[model samples]
Target: RTRMGQNQTSIKKEKLDDLGNKTHFTQKQLKELNKQFRKESPSGTISQDEFNEAMNLMGVVDPFLQNLVFKVFDKSKTGTITFSDFVNGLSIMTKGTQEEKLKFAFEMYDLDESGYISKEEMTKILESFYKLIGPSDDNPLATFSGKKYDAPQQLVDEIFEQMDVSGDGKISLAEYQEGAIKNPDIIQGLKLFSES
Candidate 1:
């Protein structure tokens, strides 16, 4: 039993070293996060249902957005996210640079992973966002010109207009990065998790 415990300690040390190098966190921080993750998911990985529960605890009640966030964390597409992936994603959302945050946001928006965001994809994400936060009376798109258009679609169109600088039908990473940097609303949308 002592030998097993020693081996586990070594394994954890190795993981902490590896994850520390890859993430912008100290060894202590990683250890705490690993402990928290283990408490939430004793199996050492988080299933979709477990993820949904965690998101609910964090006040992200929209299942679509929760699933989207889950997919982003499950980088391997293995139907579950390991602690390593979880911490990596958390690092990006919490401590990563602006460019890194924007890239992560771009990945979230690029639902199909086609390296671009289509109007439909953006609209769907916007719809999910509205569902998560509910309709806002102060929404800029609430009643433009005294008309109640589909706010999600209007937001998508506005975003596409700002982001599709090449006049292309889809938004590439470069365009997304550039557009997000220029637009505070885009940046806010990208930082939804952190800001929320």
Candidate 2:
């Protein structure tokens, strides 16, 4: 009886330790997790295949949602989004309510706060967002999605290029904020993404 009780206590102690470790996420870690979750979907340059894959991954197969997403990406009204258009659409989709989302957009894209968003600023924001959400050394994408793929670097670069308007290699906070506000779906998506 004494030996059995000791074993039970030891097991309980181990379980408690495991729970404690799992519950503690630093701010940086949480930010990274958010970023990784975002990247699971194609952001700036989403091929039709990639978009479809993202829909499947997110379990959002509703026709209405699909149409809405398609519309968002159809920036040229050309009925099909090119790689650059797809990326821009994804960035737009990540936006939220004008008032609330603008704060985050400004902070993220405004490196100089010159009342304008530059291409470099946009690229920096995208890179940071990708880094924060993309798989890290400690936490790989497979761990979260239970699937494997090539490294996310290519996708990240593609997104940055798509968002960097003016061909100047940057995007200003103002630009981001304006884009975000224009798309209500993106704002809604942002809320849902953050809550999760």
Candidate 3:
């Protein structure tokens, strides 16, 4: 796949422009990420099926999020991702600035690139999360300043309330970014990025 927005270059140039933008990544992170990437595809390229298996093995159970990730990384939309594409995608996910992270998060949630996240979309995503990590003992709640959740719906409701700045029940791109900036961890929860 062609890169999301990048000039074609060699391995050295890929490392130099690790983020696909102006942001560059550290050699150590690049080396480690590449090592991980190599384990998945010895040919230095990853197809859609292989990418799905890799994320599933990594314990990412959310299918929707996994699809979103594939799209973001597969810039060319050729159903495959090269080493350079992987590195640039990884750098943006892990080391990009907050605005970058917010944009990525918005894209993931936007679904149709409609520039707005409707209640239906939000509900679907939230249900996926609830399925992955509910309030059971295996998945205790940690939101609300460590308060336990009464129900999964409460968490979803709270997010909608805080993020729907227009009171229209739908979150616009601007509203999504503002909410993500206010709660940076929300963007980090995309699972492509590390907590650090």
Clashes of each: 0, 18, 1
Q: What are the per-residue Cα lDDT tens digits for candidate 1 across 27-138?
A: 9999899888888789989999988998999998888888888988998899999998899899998888888888887888899999999999988887877776567764
Which sequence of candidate numbers ranks them by lDDT, best first? Answer: 1, 3, 2
**How well does each candidate superpose onto the true structure, as a TM-score?**
0.86, 0.30, 0.70
* lDDT, model 1: 0.82
- List the RMSD of every prediction in angstroms: 3.2, 18.9, 5.9
What's the true lDDT of residue 196 in model 1? Answer: 44
Q: Comparing 1 and 2 by lDDT, which wins? A: 1
lDDT of 3: 0.69
In model 3, what are the clashing residue pairs, if there are any? 2-76
Colliding residue pairs in candidate 1: none
Among all candidates shown, the one with the greatest lDDT: 1
Q: Model 3 over residues 1-196: C-alpha lDDT tens digits?
A: 5673355546556665544344456666666667887886898788878888878877766878688778878777788898777876766776777777777767766777688887777667666666766646434232532345556567667777888988998898788888867865465455444442
Give lDDT per model, in order. 0.82, 0.47, 0.69
Which rank order by TM-score, best down to worst?
A: 1, 3, 2
TM-score of structure candidate 2: 0.30
